[model samples]
Target: MAFFCQTDSYATELLTEVVSCSPAQLKTENGGKKETLSGYNVILKDTVLFPEGGGQPDDRGLIGEVPVHRVTRQGPEAVHFVSSLLDPGSEVLVKVDWNRRFDHMQQHSGQHLITAIADSLYGYKTTSWELGRQRSFIELDTPTMTTEQAEAIEQLVNQKIRQRVPVIVRVITTDDPEFNQVRSRGLPDDHAGPVRIIDIEGVDANMCCGTHVANLSDLQVIKILGTEKGKKNKTNLIFLAGERVLKYAARSYSVEKSLTALLKNGPEEHIEAVEKLQKSVKTLQKNNLTLLRDLAVLTAQSFKNSPDRSKIFSLHRKEGDNEFMNIIANEIGTEDTIVFLTVGDEKTSGLFLLAGPPEIIDQVGPRAAKILDGKGAGKKGRFQGKANKMSQRGEVESLLQGVLNGTAPKEE
Candidate 1:
């Protein structure tokens, strides 16, 4: 049923009678796993806790010393999901989490103010709005918004906040003449009875059921962060209101300070210094790759003078890339020589490569990949694939050696 929060937005606690309480099960996901939790659905005669509605999240708090995890509205009843069931017809103390409630109030009210300003000044209708935990967004009908336009809207909204205008809530019948004057997304088809209208003094009057502060000054400030292109021709404007704006500013300042210290540059020069460092790192990486290629060639040359030069050579390199292995294989491969190479770190997965005579690869490539639990194809005497089970590297090397020595069953 309708509650005190619908009319009085500032109410944080209410002592009400429990209408009903029933056992319920809640299914939730945690860390990619689905879990079923046991709880009870407790309905109160009147509640201060606001149910999740109209893009705003539900309020969380305690009911008679038991934690209320979720509050949802079913028809006119507010359902409180708690761990233990309360007796029907018993009185309970309902407390709303003030921090969460106030944050929501600021963001939701800020959205209405911004939306009204956008429509009034630029004729941009708000298509949708989302009240997020730390940030909020309103999707506009327009495809793009200029930086200057956004700044103007921010300035205008903050000006209203400075005026400290009263935010009044009024309830009126559906047939009331003033109903037509109030702006709204429009009433639901099934909605009946009185309509709650929120009026910002000398600013806007809209039909909304969400809780809001008594005055615009309670919002403290509003910041329009940026905008992104949304679906079709819509533009999503990101913003932070009230204490969230302060929190974001503090976090950003801390990050900037750390970045400046680490980069050994002032705030304005940090970006330039980081760009230069990145370029130097890229150059060093390229040089290091060249050195690795040269080292691979030298390693291949060292094996050239080996007295036991077999037709099939199996090499295991713990510190080299696929390119390095390929270079070594290309340098040492002959018409009859088959080189089986694997390279990777001990802690993670590795790569496998088979290169040499086309006939040998065609016979052994697929078989090797299958044994290593990997997938690949061979063409023009080269086959390469990833080895999923890195810990089996030693076994893979032994299997290759066995195949080469004729101790293991050879591929047909």
Candidate 2:
């Protein structure tokens, strides 16, 4: 059955009766997974809302006061998914989201025009197309596109829009004589109604089921933003049409304004300013690393000079890394005194290193790994890795003390 939106793309509201509302079992997501659902599948007697079909998203609107989030076609009927149940045979007002509907119409029609022109003018058949949230892409049966070819195509596509070419819709049985002449991309396996032929007068005739603008003028404009390499044997042409192009311009200008204010420069100098800022950041990072090394050496020297230093030493630093821990371990000379060092948030996770006698290193490494909820490996009296529970540093200290007192137990 031809949906009301497909026949009358401009209609935004319709009065309809509910045919059936059944409890939903599951909904299909990406990867063919069916998740448990919490909604009812409603079938309207007639609907103005469009179901997701032919590379177009389903229309969003309302069935009475309840919002209809999604609509899909099961065979010939448009199944509307709604949260609240509506009684069968009861009348309800169906409303279509006009902005979304018209946007889809503009992009779908614009894609048809581009596909038709590209195939006829350049012999690049459109293998597929996408209706993206920001920009749409048309995948053509070619390896690459040049700047000159892109400019020429954009110019010609807009010329037709300027000429206000009429977009006519014809619904006919599949066996009609005219059906054989139109550019058909094939119909759905469950298609039950007449085939639709969207005719752009004097330009092209394409078999499409999605909603479309009444004329090329309704598209407002078509901007070929750029092209990208698609699959091994194809190229994708990226473009935005109608309100999307306007939205793109608005967002670009807003970003430009913010950048100009932050960089203290005009749009022309923003790129150069950003480059200079990045260079300065690199210099500061180099200077900071040098300071951290100096601080690590001084910290180790302070521990070595203390007269009352214990054989087992523990230290924690908030803003140090693995390199800093290794430097302190080397400076303090951990052959005789066992050292426990950590760098990160005291209450969270960070890097840990234990460097001391080989016997204790072997015994305590596995125990530390379990306590810290992390993993590590070492040889020649050095064990280090990430520790998720740096907050459990006390438990690690107790285990190391057990090694010092010769009371550490052997695991079976």
Candidate 3:
């Protein structure tokens, strides 16, 4: 039989210690070996500096004026990574950038409030959290929720922010009876110490390892940017909080002003102006279609007296507006005729080729596709491809003749 003794698992430290130490810079030589510095991991001893876990990024700061380049978790310990290598066994004073830590705490706490609101409002549980460079998103267990529900949850989160309830952190043994009432994803099986539970008064209680603000008011505002659906019944709820909210608001205001200027209307009237423009575009499209029909008729008349004895007609339509080419192709046909039309619009060009009769189509269709560098196959020997480049009408006509004479093979 063996007996094991228990001891305090958490470390305690004072902020004054971090401030008293002088900052140092390291010079590396000979491929990352022989390091000499008096730097030690700060929160490693006190369990304060955030460790990488739970989809949340670790806290960033300087220790004794040496900026922490990274924070990684090894087994159950958080290894603070500094740019300069440190002596393995040396004990050095450490410091954390209190502002950065506090800001992150506010953001993380705000996320809890918003996610909890989502769960309360729509039975959505946060299955994951991603802290990104400029923003963060909480992934919900349920992928879908009505827009009304999302708006309502956003409103409720803001209301809670206004209420400003106290945030309490309690350390408890895994065997605590009250732990059962706190709905959470449960602790990691590998966690060896006591669990730290963060409770937002009567709002929410969950197991978390990240730092947090003491009061909800410290979070300022939490703005839900939008929601996006993900795989496997999950959705990402994007949001920003505290100082980020102000930055977002300012940027949005600037964008709105720019849009108003471009649209020639105030922000309130922007939607109406856009609708008007859309209606105008729709009307113009109808008129353009009518014009294309008339132009196709004129194009057909020109070909009626074509001088070419081979029945190969090459015509170019205005850049873009493929409707005319399609209309022309469908209207005219000969026993062994191939029609080539090129249309160009400002940005893109189109090509249309129509061949008639099985023998004629087989000879000309593949040749047209080859010459145009496009692809199409049809039972009636019709083919179409966007012109690979503009000004290929002559080449297309020449290829049609070559294929008809059995001199050209089908393009690969």
Which structure among the candidates has the greatest TM-score?
A: 1
lDDT of 1 by residue, 220-296 (tens): 99999999999889999999999999999999999999998898789999889989999999999999899989998
| Pairwise lDDT winner, candidates 2 and 3 | 2
Cα lDDT for residue 392, candidate 3: 55
Residue-level lDDT tens digits of model 2 in 3-93: 8888899999999999999998546575677576689999998899999988888899999889987898889899999889899999999
User: In order, what lDDT does every prediction score?
Assistant: 0.86, 0.91, 0.67
Worst 10 residues of 3 by lDDT: 1-10
Instruction: Compute the lDDT of residue 396 as modeled in candidate 2.
Output: 91
- Using all chains and alpha carbons, the TM-scores for the candidates as numbered come to 0.88, 0.87, 0.66
Clashing pairs in 2: none
Model 2 per-residue lDDT at 251: 96
Flag clash pairs in model 3.
318-344, 319-344, 319-345, 320-343, 320-344, 320-345
For candidate 1, give the lDDT: 0.86
Better of 1 and 2 by lDDT: 2
